[model samples]
Target: METTYFTKKDSIVRQIWGKADTILFIFAGAAAEFALNKAVDWLYYTGRLPKDPLGRLFSTVNYAKVIVFAEEKTAFQAIDQMNKIHAKIEENRGFKIPDWAYRDVLFMLIDYSIRAFEALERKLTLHEKEEVFQVFLKVGKGMKIADLPTNFKDWEIQRRSQLQDNFEYSDFTKDLFLQYKKHLGIIRYRLLLEAQILMAPKRIKELLNFRNQSILIAIIPFYRLSRIFKIDYILKELILPKDYKSDIKALDHSAAH
Candidate 1:
């Protein structure tokens, strides 16, 4: 029998995610929003996210790639494992993670995938954006997350509402930014801020007090040129810490394949 992947072989979702730079931008946006999320305390609950924010970022990337690249059965198993892990967390916490919190995460994946791709590449067609939404919607369904918006247009509305309703700069947000600065050090932390400015939504930027423009906006054209000469990995290396060089390199599925 032929292998069936969770994402189809020619999928635009794969094209967006298969590149290291795009994936980095996705997480840059996510990292900012995650810190501001009302439910960020659940991430802090285990002390893992606070201890090593960059490591946690890479770990989440690995899980996402497994779902995006693996065969269908393997992808379902990965999703099941994620559900069990969350169930255990809920068990320990003596309450369920809010369904809206779950939906917020799913929305992040969908939103950032589009934002990152557009920032680094080009705008996706309406159909391509829908493709991205549907893929993550399936993952949400797999996790048994309820009341997800059924289609892309509806998702856009819900996404905006969630951004307005769910984010605030609490103490958790402050401490998490401190953790990010600590792990990433001063220079890279600043770069992260710039990337977030480029990738995050207006509400996220407003809440975080990020400036309206990022220096990365000017640099992106040069960076895209470097990709043509096949030297962009050098810049990616400099953007992240030395310890995660391998992880950063592994993110380029083109290199692995």
Candidate 2:
């Protein structure tokens, strides 16, 4: 599925068949990614540090990019270079980012950057445009928007109403209903913390599963990593218990072996 967070790919499948499963998948993705983003931000701002310079660089850049640019990739790249210097210093400072975590963060940022570029380049549909705007709102951008419900049935009426009153809704109005009618459309979506975090291209239509009255339903993840106590654990757990016991294992395993 294209959308890691209740997005385009799932929406498309829901359209063709009106399947509840696909709709739920999209909502799950959205909520999952949304929560992860927020938690990552909170943990980061709390001054937690990864034992690697690269991780430091990635986290810093991610937070700054949102605050400063609000999804503007142009600005992200501009500061990204400065972050390179920080990366170099981190090595000597006794902090080092692992190759996997480093790669994951970079991949996600790249994916998001590409999406931003495409939307600007290709004139996104009115609803698509609103989705992007809502993304910014979720990430703590300056512009304020309402917190949409994660349920399709509830969101369908609420979000449409918001768009109608808040945005310059013209031809876009019909498009929203059509997408929803297809049963592949989403009223709400989010990101979350989970075993496998799914990520998707920024543009929903770009997902591979696009088709007519489509038979396939899909679920995608931003990506997944094992959970742990974030004060410090140089190694990624990749899998762990849901309760507090697992964190004990994480802390011990993290000790120099």
Candidate 3:
């Protein structure tokens, strides 16, 4: 009898496993993980253990909305993450998640996480989903939920200083946010960048034209709000500039004219 001749011709998914740029992936993954942890913590904190039963339930629903809305707006941050995942896997091997597909994955993750909580005991309807997303987005995004205020300050100082050096090239109001002195306030410095991105959403190419060249700061803002004057952006933009923070003249300039 001619015994079994089995050849597993089927190959693994090229889409799933890309390559292995481990270092980049780790840092990128850390960012993604960090965001999730904070959101989850928010859930836990708001999930009333005792107290008013109806109010506690409402709070949980409110929190869920925040998570959903976050995904909707910051969906691109996750898409950007695919590049991180793709880059790492591509290094070892070669696979990819297309740009078009990224949006779906982001929504799926957002919905799944919330649905999971709702399924356990609370029966969630689609209407509830919509309500949660819109409401949370309005409230949470402004709160700077995941980031510390100091980070926001550093970025503002750095961006403004850099702009001061090259303000002539300033196209529009690409505001850089710094902490208000002696208090927790984020001040904004104008930049040419925001003028384009916000003023004209349809002319996307124009918005990105000055990207890499806009301001190459070592401290990249959290990949999520890399666009905004986020704190992570500050760490990378300010801490890494050559002699920027230490140069007494620059410091004086920041204070003076």
Candidate 4:
């Protein structure tokens, strides 16, 4: 089947998201939010994240992948389904999820989309960055999030404020890191933390007590060098989790429509 413009087989978003390393890096940033954002943490009261943080994150990534790469009708359905799920969570919680918190998640997607791609590949053009912003802007519109900025520049300003207002170092943050350590092992968890520190907003790094550093920045040169040598797959295998190795391997640069 032919792809639509949104998920066109060669679309920039598809190619960015199709790489497993990019998805993982995106979640590394998102992981900081999940750990520190109190309002956002309320959405996970089911204890799923506490038990299996990586699994919960991958579930979110899978939902987004379906929405991004599926055909228009199917993509809309996936999005509608996601909205309904959030609505149900709010109903059960007996209070509305705050709009700022909703926007925070949207911003993370936008920020991490850029961070992940730049880490793995070359820097995107300004136009391409706007495209990343637009894709998630559309997703947020589908979920009916209120007061989103009209464009990427405005959104970048608002995103910084949201990060400042929404996140902190709480007991939830402490426990979530412990869970990440349990799941990823000590070495991988340290790597994950460093990745998060590198990609997170400056305030978030302060809240997490992580120094500003990019282990990935130093390593990205090697990643790019490997790509030039066509041995990138070897490095990817070494970095990703053994349990999800097969699943990550299946991600393709040009997924079928």
Among these predictions, the greatest TM-score belongs to 1
| Per-residue accuracy of model 1 over 1-257 as CA lDDT, tens digit each | 89998998889989988988888899898899899999999998989998888888778766887799888999999999999999999999999999999999889989999999999999999999999999999899999999999999999999999999999999999998999899889999999999999998999999999889999999999999999999987887777789887887787854234
Q: Across residues 1-257, which tens digit of lDDT does each residue of candidate 3 receive?
A: 43221111121111111111111122122222222221222212333322232233223332332222233335335334535644664464444433222222232223333333332224445544444333323333333233211332342343234323321212111211111111212221122222222221122223234332323122222333543543443533542223222321221221110
Q: In model 1, what is the error at residue 54, expressed in angstroms? A: 1.3
What's the ranking of the predictions by TM-score, best on top? Answer: 1, 4, 2, 3
Instruction: List per-prediction Cα lDDT, in the order shown.
Output: 0.90, 0.30, 0.27, 0.80
- Tell me the lDDT of model 3 at 249: 21
lDDT of 4 by residue, 1-257 (tens): 75564455666788778877788888898888778886746746776778878888878877777777877787778889988987888898888888888887788888988988887777898888888888888888888999999788998899888877778788888888888888988878888988897788788888888787777678778877887899988876767789987767665543644
Give model 2's TM-score versus the native structure: 0.22
- Number of colliding residue pairs in each model: 0, 35, 23, 0
The candidate, 1 or 4, that scores higher on lDDT is 1
Q: Which ten residues in a row have the lowest lDDT in candidate 2?
A: 187-196
Which of the predicted structures, 1 or 2, would earn the higher lDDT when compared with the native? Answer: 1
Clashing pairs in 1: none
